[model samples]
Target: MTRDITIVGAGWAGLAAAVKATQLGLKVHLFDAANAPGGRAKSVAHQGQLFDNGQHALIGAYSETLGLIQTMDLQPQALFERQAMKWQYPRGECYALPQDAYPLKALRSLLFSKRFSVREKSTLLKPLFFSVSQALWGKTDDTVAHLFQGVSPKIMRDIISPLCLSALNTPVSVASANIFMRVLKDAFANPPQSCEFLFPRLPLSDIFPLPCLNWLRERGARIQLNHRIDDLQDLDPHVPAILAVPPWQASLLTHDKYPQWSMLAKHIKHRAIASIYVKGLRAESDSKQAPSSSYPGSLMCLNDHDESEDCVHPQFGLQRDVNASTRNSHPEGAEHWALIVSAADPNARQTIIENALKAACEQLKLSDVQLELCTVEKRATFSCDAHLQRPPCWIDSGLMAAGDYVQGPYPGTLEGAVRSGFQAVTQLVDASFVSSHAGNTSRVL
Candidate 1:
């Protein structure tokens, strides 16, 4: 029997497509090489602890991603902070961007914050006064560095660069000026809290993928696991197959289908990330007067090295040294803090972890704590490079491709992945309607 749809790769993109398509009343078949779902966000159990292969945080601007999560009926509180992000600089000075709608609050915070130089603060506010002409015009034909020309190197190095790299997973220089602009637009457009930072509290498998997987099974969607299709020819002669695989892998399949896929395939680029996970018997949050789930400086740029101190700021999530001891198992003195660090460059994985651990200890003043466990994960993701080729939703008659790699305005993020899947399913539905109409006409003939 011809299934209504066959989606390749059970990653976030594929799984999202499966759920959405199935809900649309199409029979869905999802194929993946991984034993589980969530792809890069998958989780693994280390001893008694369940740790995600990497860390993922959701922003309030990510409405589509959050909508999907909400649709799955997962408890939002379990998966996200749903509050304003709290940032701590290396000097122990702290800032809370606040989770509220007042732009004035953000403006005030910038004014009083000691983190930025007078010049830096002015450069940051330049966005507010940017010519309404240029604002409407969006990104100029300049690099990110060009965008921040007069800003202090400190602001760029410590703040903007880290935020950009974490979101786009590319260095500021390499990231598209337009992409970075979108990030700014979202932050400023929403109520300050609308941009709340949300990371998965449970393992990623459970947070994002497992619920969808279970739903697919209950709905009788055919899910094939541990099967890697190295070649497109390996797929059955099924029309409407969605090739929701990665870029390098997609490149191989597109070589023969240039007439069909060359344009889309060329727009996709891969960036790599490494995640270092450390176990804490106590939650790092307990140590602070106000516990924080994420720290902005944890994921710093490759070049932002200050050797005077051994530890770097925890930019993305936790800030602590790799050598710091896990706290006790409760707030009294315990709760494990899992320090997860990520960077686009694969080579600097070790050094980043070392520096991160060092910084965590220095900032927390926990040099005397006992160590628990440290593990590193490389190949976190393929950089979603700008100007790469993207394949179409439908290809080779019965075959289609989906995933973040499919055509989209944004890079390969959770939103992009979901959008791609939604697009492929739409294409399939349209094509099916046309095919059915033609068949009925043939009978009349």
Candidate 2:
């Protein structure tokens, strides 16, 4: 059980740490509670179809993620679709968010698209104008909303808010300006092609974790699945263990040799994501039409007027049954479509899913859609709330923590998780080198 490095959790962060540690010639033991890898990003099977737990998309600016993908040598195109994305809204209204999916094509669409008023389009340019300056020099106390409020009418409510909420998983009003600026810099400052948004064509686990697993195995890293750490013990003085387990789990382990670091533990919050997958009998009539295509899934916020209180599931995008086009009718007489709704609060999920299903039906014009199978998944992940209790990247001597909960500008995102792992590995490698050098110098003296 003695390992130079022991990584808990086989999610992207843990996997990333293993990959990097193995590269540094360090022996790593990777452990996870899941039977397989990919944590939240994994896939699930239902009846005959394979569906992802949620829809995940990455932008060209995700250099680190893309680099990891390359390192695994997985065909990016096989798993992901790197192309221009369509920003859809109600009334069948759609606009192309400016990036390299097709820069010239998007520009032409923006100029003529009726998605915004001419005045709003002019306002949209406000971000482009200030994006460079902000990116280069960095932003101030200006929150994303504050900085872009008056720039463009369309930009504020439509573009900025939606984009910010989607990326940060928080409302635009409170989303950080620095993080928002980093997004702008990645898009506008980097090559247009580099900004191409990437969405996995396959399930997320296939896209996120499987590749890392294969890569780690080839690199000689040991992966332990279904092996949850019950407790941490025997931390001899000056020996530190990375407590990368969940905060709740960490609290249970507080009686261990090291409880002082557990103070940063209370700041962590548990957030739940509830997803309802509905499979219904497809009508024989619609069999000629394509089954799955996403609409810009939109829901009206309930409470906040500034759209702050409304639990607008920006990521609540849609998935229509692609099988509808080919088959005249479901053999089982069930129409199929996947509705995924995630929220921090479980009580609110019921309302969110009911309203979302209604909106999805109206948008897809499938009012007669009957639910054959409705499955709900709760306890999706920990909340990545702003100002939460987050510990530093490096904790005690020879020990470190890396997960979505660690110090980062963003919340519990794949990017945040991976970044934490990357940073943790960096600290571990650097510290080890320094330790070795110091010991050698002392012996010589």
Candidate 3:
């Protein structure tokens, strides 16, 4: 029980905690019900080819995630396709700041950028610069919808809505303004080059999970895949545990053992992320590698994002490897696309999938396409509403929770999940949760 930690659930969060605990020279036992890692963001194999269950991307601001990959000795650049964060539509309206550009030069690029009109550009910068005032005066502590008071419809249609949906997974009307502002500040003003997007070069699994399992095994950390933990009491009471499962599942495990904590975890609401996989994409319609570099076609915002309806889902379904090489992995090769619907209701899966696919086809000019699969991450992310209060990490003395749902500045993103897991283990070590079993606890950094 001494210096030994049990990590339940091997999603990004659980895996992160286990990694940190092992790095601090502790015994790590990681378990997940799923046969493979990557939790909700894992790659699913069907008909012999791999497809991501949910779409995932990274920003340079995700230092913890990037560091975790590096800790495994895997090159981040090798796993992902990096580009400056830009919101480009099929019809050509877009907005982005170059990765190498920063400060005044960046502002100039944005100011004169043809993405939006002169007035619309002001609408865009208002909230960004407004972050300065918010920091100086304290948090606005309101809904993101409030930020659009003077914004024109074009700006809302071409800009704000998509960013809000892609970032928060919640509509602008309810997404936390404080959190949204924090994301904007971190991506832009807080540091340099963080605005770049990191799209996985292959299936999401190959990006981190499988490699992490290998790294953990090599270090003598025990991993139990397809091993489910239904009851908390079944765990060695003396051994510390990190529950990184979804809030609902955690609620079930801790219902009687920790009623109050269970309530907190149970009360958290969730929104679904439905990933619609489409095949038979023609190269002319495939934007992943457009003839022109200016296309920025890897990820594009689709139409039908009704601002009044409060949805800003990104319509990304382009193939990552649109070459002959991928044909061996997937029958369609260059034609696989994973279109996503953020904040979709899982109960209405069929309706949502049908409408989303229709919108994507018409908007992206996709033709002769066939629906390969539809993955609905039932609890993709907790609803990031303005009124939300995320649960704390420490649930009890030797027990704690780790997930993006826990209290964090960022939204329910992979970075937030990674940071939470890493910090949970750090807290365990600092609090001497593993000290009685071992003497040298200074290894934790």
Q: Where is model 2 more than 4 Å wrong at Cα?
A: 1-3, 47-49, 97-113, 121-142, 151-155, 234-243, 247-261, 269-274, 279-307, 310-315, 320-344, 370-389, 433-445
- Residue range 188-294, candidate 1, lDDT tens digits: 57766455666554567777798988888999998989988777677666536777877556667777765447545654555555444433333455446433335
Tens-digit lDDT track for model 3 on 1-445? 3778989999999999988888778889999999999898788877766777776778888888999989988998877778776655666645656555347434665676787678777766666666668889896488887766567777676566677878888878788989987887778764455777787776778778999999999999999999999999779888888999989988899899799989998999888778777765555546563323442226767755563332334344444552321335545433456677777767777776677667556665566667777888777898888968778898888888999998889899999999999878877877777753344665432
For residues 1-445, could you state the per-residue lDDT of candidate 2 as single tens digits? 1235777778777877777666656666777877888766676665665656654567776777777777788867766666555555544356655543443454466678776778877765666666667757765645566667676644455656666655665556665666666655555445565556675656677676887888888878778899887765533333334555655665566546456656676556554544545544435665444233432222221111134433523234444333432223454544445554434345665565665566445544454655433433344444444334576776666677777777776566677777778788777656552122222221110
Q: Which of the numbered candidates is closest to the native, going by highest lDDT? A: 3
Query: What is the clash count for each candidate, in the order shown?
Result: 51, 15, 0
Candidate 3 wrongly placed segments (more than 4 Å):
104-109, 124-129, 190-192, 281-297, 307-314, 322-334, 436-445
lDDT of each: 0.60, 0.58, 0.76
Error of 3 at 242 (Å): 1.0
Better of 2 and 3 by TM-score: 3
